[model samples]
Target: MVTKTEETQLNRLENQVDNGGGGAWEYLCMVRKLKVRRSVKVLKHGLLILNDSKKRSSLGPEEWTLYEQVAVAAMDCQSLEVAKLGGMRFFVLKLMQYVICNLLQDCANALQKKFPESKRVGRLEAMLLEAKGSWGEAEKAYSSLLEDNPFDQVVHKRRVALAKAQGNLTGAIDLLNKYLETFMADHDAWRELAEIYISLQMYKQAAFCYEELILSQPTVPLYHLAYADVLYTLGGIENLLTAKKYYSSTIDLTGGKNTRALFGICLCTSAIAQLSKGRNKEDKDSPDLQSLATAALEKEYKQRASDKLSVFTSGFKSLKVSS
Candidate 1:
């Protein structure tokens, strides 16, 4: 039998849903309201549905949001059972609600309680300690984990990331080199190691990394561009000429739409022109070098201008329609 109070609660829920504001938190608030009024049966019935395997498919992002909200609420209310179940669900969600959402401590504590002594939990605890700036503790935890599982990929990646976060570029480089020994096919790792080398003014190492990337995926323009840039940085007549070839390849791969390639071509051509200008003024290649650079600059400028004009025209049409 629906009583007056139940009718009022139903009306409130209907109103909230109709207004498009019935999110996870709002539903949980409604649950709390019912509980405060001693509506245990209704609360338990709703909990049963949320816990049901049969109803899992119907839940979307909002439902997961509710799970997190309820988990925190359970922790606050000292309800271990709810917190345990919520933590398990969150682990299945791959621990997203913890670190990425920025409530690291709460989720970490909840997960630890649910699965104390779990390897994944230990990893997360180490990360959480690192996040909290307890570097000593974090390092100890990472060291212990590594000692236990030397080749654990997840732990290895996290250790490298932790080294980077601690401003230890050399350490990070060493760790990545060790990692690549076992996982040589990780293209992104090679690229990242190259970036670190570039930042550290280690052009030779950066060039080697880009060379590895080129060998692994010869057709990619990005690797060509990077190799060109690094060679340009480590400038000499031979390096400049090699840089020019790579830049030309980059331009070909991208159909001349790449500004970096255009500028690189211009720079290499001018430098080569100067180098060969030491030859007799009548040299064909030296004179043609200037022409090549001029043509590249002019073409790049015109392409960029055309692109900007198209963007402006589209924006103006969009405003006209909206008005």
Candidate 2:
């Protein structure tokens, strides 16, 4: 985990790079180390270094990596260009302000020519096919890679992504299920699977995924909040109570800074309150919990979003929790 201090420092360096202050290399290194995405900066600065023969030559073997990095960043921005080598022109496509497809093809071709046996280069080709909307070619390329190395995690992920890009949610889920069977410890895949399940209204499966996530990283408030949401959607007396507990856990884990969890508390309590009415027995949950959550929500709004305070209060009033 990058410390808050380190993140602040990175933000400062990133701003410096944006303003042409010349710390692009250091900023890129830190961003990569932290696994953060700053593609705009990466493309702008990486191309500066890659396109310069003098600076590019100084890095030796690492220059290849910078080429790949810039290529990937350019793909993210979807910028296009044409690469001319030995009088042969290759059209490069880009998107959203970044030089993309053709530039990526240029980089991939260069890498493959230099290291013909490299699996990474092959994967890059597959990615290029995906970028160009050649779904069949991309699928075949990914399949071939997997045939060579059944354990190629990257290829497996790309295949799943390809399925998603093709609007095959069912296929994505199937692929993810199989992927998880082998890479059971991949939290990101699990989270992604959970999200897909949620999107499909497969709440039971989503709940299971969230449960696995919570077991893997119990301290992550996001898992708790997500699990609470799924349980709340499941909606029964038992599920509601369980959802309330998870929501409370999320609130505790976030130190009461999670407004969603607070609102969840209010909603769960209100629902439980309604369900318990006329049962001829007092509910065990404290009525004050809802009021406390409401108060905290109001305070949060007052401190940071006073302009929206009326809307917030009115929403609670609609939920009949204003009292």
Candidate 3:
């Protein structure tokens, strides 16, 4: 049901669009704020405007790109009601959708036919293959493109992503490392490799990535946080000591607003203090860390968790009583 207030807001937004005042992004935002049924109509209208060939040339290249996205979202909504009851026909419909996606690949090829050596066309083809779940085909296409020009950053990134998508983490890591060997200054690739390493519990490898990242951009608080967290996880007195310093730096950088930094400082300080006492200090299995761990855990929770939980609970109770 469209509430009266929402209807009034929709009217104002639509008027803004019809007046040729709002841009594609603002219109897209308005569509998103609407119900899916309403959004479908809005998106359909957007495609209609985008497909207006006479006015199309007056639009920017980005408008053309946005048209493709609008078309996809519109089709998603338009197909839903027919498929909701669920049958073998739904599977058939999905296949039909895949066929439509393949048509985009055909269109890309048609564009490339005139400019046979166009990198953009080749990139589009590989991406379309990926989007349509033709992983092997996409991998081959990306590889062929890379073979043609080994320095194609876009193609290399797609190939690495394809490897990860195909559950070949090791292959992805190897490819990333090889890429980094040639392009060591590619911060984005370094960050991606570091995340993959962290997921695999390779804290030392992740730390190395953070070390590179910090060396490249020392003032980035996020890199410092990542480095501190990794060292903290791979606990040792020396690592914890270093972690605490980085954590303090993080707190300073963020003006003490980062809860993770706050937790890290508390936990590392307690651990270091307990270690300094030298009681069963050589034993990694000692229960001596337990008491401090408990206090550290409680202090961490008190810093943010309890406050947020109380607010949530109070809101819920108030809603219940009002209802």
Candidate 4:
């Protein structure tokens, strides 16, 4: 029932929405509410084209030519709304792929000059490209962003993530360390750095980071649980006791339904038992060590036994058991 002019206007509106123009969200909501049916074939083919575009370099010239054919076909559909939606979707998909593949340098530079307000688009494009598999590209993007906006916490975080992803643990650690020096109260950064150190098997460094997190947010159950896990990993009775204390604190804070904290507590108790068992085996006549090992083993066994039936129950029953 729509006229040609109306269709053109609708198409233009859709394009505007796709490009993130003002009122896109309102228009999109209206379109969704309208429930206008679109050609499934057009939608499917557009998605296919977008998918093909993701592996752009993998496609031979002939394959690329075929993709162009599909894209054109998808764009030439009868429904103006469908065509507009499909085109916008295709652009975003391709853009994301280009960013992931580190092919966004040209696009970033072009967009920066042409659309300065969309600097995020350029930066995101470059970051995505770097994230896909090109640390070099990511580093360039971060360096450029840092030069332009030295106080960009987001860019700093991205650089740290990229560095860690690229197996540059030392670089990641150093950057995080510097960030923490300036943002001394950032528990999230400390936790992230601790996780990175744990991944790299740098237990001592991980422990230090965990200590920092605990200092900042001592009441956070996860922080205590994580610190305890790290301490347990480092393998010392003193540390094991410290880990148990943290795990207990976490359990108390979470009201004991935190299965992860419970698991850690169980593991720590078992560890203490194992350590005591080893010591007792070394000196069989040590009654004090034997008594401690037996107590730890019994406590671990009781906790596990209590947990067996609590696993399957849910809702009120689970709450009752947990309480």
Index of the highest-TM-score prediction: 2
Report the error of model 4 at residue 228, Å. Answer: 1.1
Decide which is better by lDDT, 3 or 4: 3
Error of 2 at 294 (Å): 1.7
Per-residue CA lDDT of candidate 4, range 144-244, in tens? 87888887787888888788767888999999999888778777798888888888899889888878777877777778888888888887677876777
Minimal lDDT window, size 10, model 3: 314-323
Q: Give the clash count for model 2.
A: 14
Better structure of 3 and 4 per TM-score? 3
lDDT of 2 by residue, 33-85 (tens): 88777787888888888888998898889888887777777666662333332
> In terms of lDDT, which candidate is stronger, 2 or 4?
2
Q: What's the best-to-worst order under lDDT?
A: 2, 3, 1, 4
Reference-based lDDT, each prediction: 0.67, 0.85, 0.70, 0.60
- Tens-digit per-residue lDDT, 1-323, candidate 3: 35668778777767776676665455655555554345454555566665576555566665545444454454344344434756888787677666555546445645567558876667777777786668889888888888889999878888888899789999999999999999998988989999999999999999999999999988878889999999999998889878877886887787766767756765665566566655535434323333333344455556658766555445434433110
Clashes of 3: 0
Shift of residue 143 alpha carbon in model 1, Å: 2.0
TM-score of each: 0.61, 0.89, 0.67, 0.53
Candidate 1, residue 6: the lDDT equals 69
Question: For candidate 2, what is the lDDT?
Answer: 0.85
